[model samples]
Target: MPNAAPEIRTFLCRSDNIGVLIRDPGTGACAAIDVPEAAPVLATLEAEGWRLTDILVTHRHADHIEGIPEVVERTGARVTAPEKARAAVPGAARYIGEGDRVTVGGLEATVWETPGHCADHITYHFGEARIVFSGDTLFTLGCGRVMEAEPATLWRSLVRFLDLPGETAVYSGHDYVLSNARFALAAEPENAALQARAAEAERLAQEGRFLIPSTIGTEKATNPFLRAGEPALARAVDLPEGTDPAQVFTALRAWKNRF
Candidate 1:
């Protein structure tokens, strides 16, 4: 029989980063997406009373993987990371690449190489669950800072997510909705949807609530990074009306870096 969809939980760690957990209800197997710090992850697991069976690393960045050792020690979870990130992350038991698969008990995650933020970054897609662990590639209304990959390469990665089903729920690596929303408005100040979303994000921030778990359909409609090719965004950003989408994307990234 096919496995049941995994249950997802998101929590904050290290101020701005967001950590994720995916648990297969049928098998009672849980996976930790990245361990910025082990304390909160351990605490969360204890609270949920779920035994962690896997650790899924998205990149080699310190904040993303520093807690792997402790979490692994505490949970005895199998560690899986991008091939390049394996050495940096201690206790990693498996290395995955684009098109590779990682099983969290009966739940299967198809990995996609997304190297814009880091050369070894990857995103996980659980098709049956209609969910994606986007890591730092695609954010709520923005994309990751281009640290290694070329601008064009990152653009391609961002575009790839658009092809997924429109309803796919995107759980990005950080809680950057407030800042990204401000930048998004600068890219499309007249967009009503963008305005409303920004207001909601601001309200959520004021209330100290999480502002993530955005949908692909929502991002496609409001995310400035994803809409670089659209005439409205191009015009708002003062780029030529018909500038190449890739160039617009490059400009947007540069602008966000300084914003």
Candidate 2:
């Protein structure tokens, strides 16, 4: 079978976080993921000779947004972001929310409202690419903090992503693998996959490399938050036997927040 031509270049930046630059082969225009700062993102675009076509902001955190002004000024690119983030995220030329689909370069990206890291946080799912830019909601080995939502909201919100295809590649806003791994071990000491993942993450980080782009399958198998209702989680968090599924999930998240 013939290999597919590459359509994007994902740059790991800002303390091992990411700013993905997706290029349109036909127009040479590029779209970037959460651009925390200007110079690095611009440098990557200039180096590749790709023009900026648009910007996609997963959420409105400063670390994820601080660069939009310069990016808009330099590229004359339109910004597409969550409707609720218009105030928090400047230069949002277009607003998107749940069930909205944004098209670029023969690809269609679907929006998902993922409100835990923040109430207005969103996930962009490029189904054809089998990838999702999870902002701060879902991470490699753990979920984001329950800052914007309560235990209940976060619990149900988390279940939404659990239904994604097993092979979907997750790209989070930051690289917290090392810390998240330790937390997972505390919560699910008996999970062999968690132990194995810690070692692999350590090796990758030691080499100054990324341990991301983890598949949904791997997360479902090892991520403690997603396994919130499992026996190990229930026992570790002191939830009584046969608790309600949602309550079990809440207990697990509460414990992890303190973990």
Candidate 3:
């Protein structure tokens, strides 16, 4: 039998950063994806009556890891950080890389080193549950800016996600759906599906609700960055049909930088 699906809660952290809590119903073991801020994380844990057992670090960016020390001091949670970011994340009890498995109670996640926004970035994929915690590397309808690696490197990391089942639920680090929707429309103006999605984004923003956990199928259809191989997206970037997908992806990312 498969493990029981974990209960997930998403709330705002500092500014636009998203804080996520995953609790395994079977053993009551809980984990936080990243500690963007301690107050909100601690409050949420207290309210939910879940004791945090693990802190999964995706990268070493100050905003992402700044609250780790405080949270650890409070909860005594064990931390799992990227091997490359060991020095940056001082409280890490275990440094992991690609192919490593992390468990909380009966829930398990496979660590994937998806470096593009930063060299230490990694994604936690719960394959059996079809859920992924994509920290900064992949967002809702948008990918991260090419900050550390070349655009091609980021493109490669994004491509790896395409291999997952379309129903996979994608939980990203930030809530940038509104901005990403505007750019997606500009990139693929003729896409009816994208037009509908943009309208939905507008409605959600009006109600002060966020668009999170977008499905891989929804992203594949509406995310311009993921559709760089499509002829329409290539044309939007002033590239001819059949251009190398990576080159098209590079052009699309460049356009997004300006958008």
Candidate 4:
């Protein structure tokens, strides 16, 4: 675990999307993870008085990468993106893959290729910082829709996150926690933790506050998608006890897609 947390600033962009500014305080190196837009990000940089040194691209989605050009033009930050989705981020200085590490201000981020939302989706794990930029692969009380891979494949990708340290803080690409909480409650209303989380998510939504940076431990306890293998969730979903977790996850994802 990290002795001190890095300086992180979160704001909304493109209405429902998330924008993140990561800073290494010691050396003053900062990164923008998936530029949803450039103006707000630049304003935040100016307010914080931190120079942007890196632009970490998680996937090729338009909302995620659209602001890259302007951001790079203004800050000259080095761009890193997935090898397969390089086209979306033209002129990206680096193409990264699983196990590749990118260093900024001496802080290292190990890349994990979590390709379910998109065939080339990737996540960044800053283990020492106990922070994971999960991209679209994982979210608070939810997981990404299996847009470019099989349900089982997506389940495997989610499992990768489940293996992270319990205290690992997760920052996702979007702010979808309100609807996710509703779906989780519908799927497992009997869960006390889920009920409590739903209420809290409602409160946050009503206040227009951001609902992210949730921890791995909290997701395990409150997220039905993460609890597919558990007997309680299996029963709640009307699947027989001991059913394959992948099947339950597939059913849950299908249900959510329609919900």
Best candidate, lDDT:
3
| TM per candidate | 0.97, 0.91, 0.98, 0.97
For residues 1-259, write the lDDT of model 2, one tens digit per residue.
3223336666666765677777657556568888878888899988988888888998888888888898889988889989988889755778999999986666668999988778889988888778788878888897778787787777677788789899988888788889889988988888898899989999998898766778899998899888876877778778876667678777777777676
lDDT of 3 by residue, 125-157 (tens): 999889999999999989998899898899999
Candidate 4, 113-225: lDDT as tens digits? 99888999999999999899998989999999999889999899899888889999999999999999989988888889888888888898889896788999999999888
RMSD to the true structure for each prediction, in A, is 1.2, 2.3, 0.8, 1.4
Query: Model 3 TM-score?
Result: 0.98
Those runs of model 4 whose alpha carbons end farther than 4 Å from true positions after fitting are: 1-4
| lDDT agreement of model 4 with the native | 0.90
Q: Residue-wise lDDT of candidate 1 within 1-259, one digit each (tens)?
A: 7677678888899999998889999889899999988998998999999999999999999999988888888878898989977678755788889999888888888999998898999999998788899999999999999999789889999989889899999999899998899999988899898999999998888888877899999999999999988998777668888999888999889989989
Higher-ranked by TM-score: 2 or 3: 3
Residue 105 lDDT in candidate 2:
67
Per-residue lDDT of 117 in model 1: 90
| Candidate 2 or 1, higher TM-score | 1
**Candidate 3 pairs with clashing backbones:** none
Q: Determine the backbone clash count of candidate 2.
A: 0
lDDT of 2 at 33: 82
Cα shift from native, residue 194, model 2 (Å): 1.8
Candidate 2 at 58: error in angstroms?
Answer: 1.1
